[model samples]
Target: MGSRTQDTEECYSYHNQNQNVDYGRMAEILVRRAGSTDEFTRLTSITWINEFVKLGGEQLVPYYADILGAVLPCISDEEEKIRVVARETNEELRAIKADPAEGFDIGAILSIAKRELNSEHEATRIEALHWFFTLLDRYCAEFLAYLNDIFDPLLNALSDPSDAVSFL
Candidate 1:
């Protein structure tokens, strides 16, 4: 119980809230040695490294993009931290004319994106829309015919009482 509390608090300790040089090098090491050889290493690569980048800044963020051979740790990633880095990496690549998913967990992303897109909260809606747009933009050909279906719930949102919701 004591360790659990410490772990939870340590997860986002203040010291980790920036792009610290020490953490960046550690993230690089984790990303490089990330292999299917064992669960611990894989989890380090998927979870801790991404957490480092999320807590760190732009400098550390770049290494996450180089980690190759993700077996779905991004799209349907079990850890939120992993998913965040994956999304960030996608955006970076999109800037460079690269496909975001990069052969990762493309299958499960759509359902989660759709569910989040209809969230009642405006902030939730905004974040979800970002993901949805990335998906649509990355795979324009595949998502074209299904835009209406994907965007159906948002249609009624056109008349939402809140300016933010309605405008979105």
Candidate 2:
């Protein structure tokens, strides 16, 4: 069997061939698997996504929105293990030094978060709010440009049935 380092190198090399297709396709796959009815499948996909984020580096910037959209809902997954891995993956993604020049699509991410804020799932809505907080913290100027677009959702969510969603 290959050493862990060798295995990781192989995975990295395999992924680096074409950033656009590889990362985008992988994010799409993870999104589908994360939404699986089977708990094990969801957990496995979340774990892989966490590793993928760690290994993909700046090449992932273009697909950041896709990855975030895929994993954000998992943060509130019914399975505790899935939730934990999903949160870790999100942290890893946030830590990535995404250069805006590398094509980070904040608009797409904002759109996803906005849609998520109206979700039926309480946890999903809560996570979406947390996403806005993170965005405001990191991309304050860019986020302000979309303030009007987001204002209505934030206003509506202020009256959410779940106190947890509104309070956060």
Candidate 3:
């Protein structure tokens, strides 16, 4: 009976170690899956942003940035499904701006503004320009300069119809 109890203890320890190993592997898999360049990942990001915005707790801001970074580059992606990711990103930015917290990064906002201005879609360009102007009004000297660098060409492009603007 004494030997059986020792054996049982060893077996339980082994089982716990195996569980830990499995959990570690599962965590890695989940991270990779979330980071995947697939439509499902993009959809999940969109859903997460929508939900996060609705909840609007302070803790989720960094998570918002993380998801945005992961999904923003896919804005110009060829896949139609992934395009929704960009739209959601724009919406998330709009939501963030509505609250106007101290933690917001002007540089990142400016980058998105430039991308929107350069978008091939006329509607997106217009929307992007609107946000650019809003940021310009709120931010200081350096941000204004950044805004000018992006906005000047866009204004020129809009004035001159010869320039092709494609959002895709």
Residue 134 in candidate 3 has what lDDT?
64
The lDDT values for all models are 0.49, 0.78, 0.50
lDDT of 2 by residue, 30-135 (tens): 6666677878777877887777787776767887887788788888788899899888888787777566667987788899899889788897888888878888
Ranking according to lDDT, highest score first? 2, 3, 1
Off by over 4 Å in 3: 1-37, 56-89, 97-101, 140-142, 145-148, 160-168
What is the model-wide C-alpha lDDT for candidate 2? 0.78
Candidate 3: worst-modelled 10 consecutive residues by lDDT: 22-31
TM-score of 1: 0.41
- lDDT of each residue in 29-118, candidate 1, tens digit only: 555544435544455455655555445534443443343224223433445655565556444433433333443333344555556555
Clash count per candidate: 0, 0, 4
The candidate, 1 or 2, that scores higher on lDDT is 2
RMSD of 1: 10.8
- Check candidate 2 and list the clashing pairs: none
- Among all windows of 10 consecutive residues in model 1, the one with the lowest summed lDDT is 64-73
- Clash list (residue pairs), candidate 3: 120-165, 120-166, 120-167, 121-167
